[model samples]
Target chain A: METAISGAILAIVTTQKDKVASGVPVFFAKDQEEVQRTCILLSRVLKAMTHDLENGVYILVRH
Target chain B: MDKTIQIIILGIIVGTAARIYMLRTDYRQYPSYPHGIVVHVSLGVLAAALASLAIPALMEKEYTAITFLSLAAQQFREIRNMERETLSKLEELSLVPRGLDYIEGIAKVFEARNYLVMFTSLVTTSVALWLGLLAGIIAGITTILISMYLMRGRFVRDIATVKPGKLHFENSLLMVDDIVIMNVGLEDQREKILKDGIGVVVHPKNDNGRAILNNLGQRQAILHDVSILVGNKLEVGEPDLTPLMRKDVDTGKLALFVVPNEKDLECVIEAIYRTPILESAAYYPLKSTIGKSAAD
Candidate 1:
């Protein structure tokens, strides 16, 4: 499911709560701070491969 | 053996050569290596052959041959669509993508170039058939030169001034000159931008230049070209480091912030100047009657 949070400032894509499936590959953040925070949390805690897009950031998770 | 056949042969050779000379892989790099070159060259040969044959067929009162020319025109329109599709797909892969307006401008140019080749061949063939071989040679050279002149559209330097500017921060925000680029919340990334980044202010010469610079596509084109030329410092996870262009709301001056691999300020300025004016974004406000009266 795709959810736009913070008045379209951040977009999150996830198949289930606390479990990001492989198919959901993109995430959007409002600015640098949000992107960095999201990427760090996803990478370190969730063990996902995150990349930055110009406007937002995306993550790749296996199942 | 016939004079008509010999003249047509000469036209095809000259016209094909002109087309080949003009097909260069430069900054934009639309028609890439091997397959792309082959496709364009083959189409060029077909166009030249059809155009050269048109004169003799008409001279002999074979009016049906004119229909073939119309068919070729229709084919070239498909070429434009092909180019647009190819570039749009490739744009997805680019680190800094060429915007839709730039892509459309490039596609249109490819279509127009093919038509030019056809016209050059027709003119050369007509001259040879009516005048002589010497006249045909002269006409061929003249047409090539004329095509070359027509192909060179305006560049950014023709209408704007690019000069280096200092990058500073106002609290947490990154500012290039007086224009604010973005808010940098992290101290580390802010330092990185300050250490490696370069800034330039583009001052439009007139209303036309202002209008062109204001186009989002044109500004993006400039950022892309500059990044390609000097090389971008952005990594996959660093959204903060993406090159950005912002216009001063009051003055209409565009400020560009780039973190390039090569730090030479002059080279960055030169690259910005050499960036081609996107045909789709080109505005000629000064040429219009209303604009002229307003200026007066």
Candidate 2:
């Protein structure tokens, strides 16, 4: 009976803002360092995994 | 004392002894420490008492005593439920949870052990009542040995061969040999993985072994076992370091990627080999005619 959301993108951290435009919250990082920091913080706070799209976009998803 | 009393006492002693002999706090660390052992041993005593009294009761023309056997069966079933509940509840707090399949297997073993105790008591008591004390002692020892033999289930090495695998990164993706484990987003994490991560490949000997490796629960069991022995780098919210098993699509071979604290490849390989083949994950496709032909 217990259920929780999984495999859903909770947030997006991207170096290129124009590349990721979705319903989820998006964090635009000015540089590679900021992008990595943002994604790691988001993943820890959200208790999710950070997966790289390998196209300037990193996604946080609970799985 | 009466001859029946002598027989009943012998049965209880042998049965309890057998139960105690079977109970051991191994690497699994199951049944907890002192309290868990106390609970199971007390239940074993009760099961033994019930079984040992049966023959004597039957000899006394107590027909109603037969119903107690049925009641004992119900009680043992409750023990299985209790074990499953306790383990499932604790699974939430475990760093590497033993999956449902492994839990069920353990629960079933707990239940079966009680039955084995009962059987040992019954046989020993009956033999004593019919033959003599010396014969009964011999029979009790024999049954205990037999129970020990029966309880020794197959390990992973019996079905598959485990060997070290090469860990490398293909851009953002982590690969154990050719099998893709997962993608790490952070540069720091990927570098840590490349340096600390140990990979092991499991090759199934036959179609049956391949089918078992395909089961997610079985894969989880391998990860859990290896992590326990080698120590896992995973922490809360740190899924990047979690041990994972991924299989090649074309072949049934599995590759495990684990960021262990020890970084010992030998221990990891040994742990994987020692993992018990879960009963739920075992598939006998080779036993069927259709599957036999399809395997080719």
Candidate 1 total steric clashes: 0
Candidate 1 per-residue C-alpha lDDT over B1-296 given as tens digits, one digit per residue, 9 for 90 to 100: 98998999998988898789889888766576789999999999998999999999999999999999999999999999999998898887676778898888889988998899899999999999889977997898799899889889999999999988989988766888999987654456778889999999999988888999999999988988998899998754455678999999988899999999978899899989998899889988899999878655
The sequence of per-residue lDDT tens digits that candidate 2 reaches over residues A1-63 is: 236578899999998978977799999989999999998898788878899998999999988
In CAPRI terms, model 1 is classed as incorrect
Cα lDDT over the full model 1:
0.80
- Top candidate by DockQ: 2
For each candidate, the alpha-carbon lDDT, in order, equals 0.80, 0.91
Candidate 2's fnat?
0.68
Segments of candidate 2 deviating more than 4 angstroms: A1-4
lDDT, candidate 2, B51-97, per-residue tens: 99998899899989978989999999999999999999999888788
Best by TM-score: 2
Model 1, residue B141: distance off in Å is: 1.7
Docking class of 2: medium
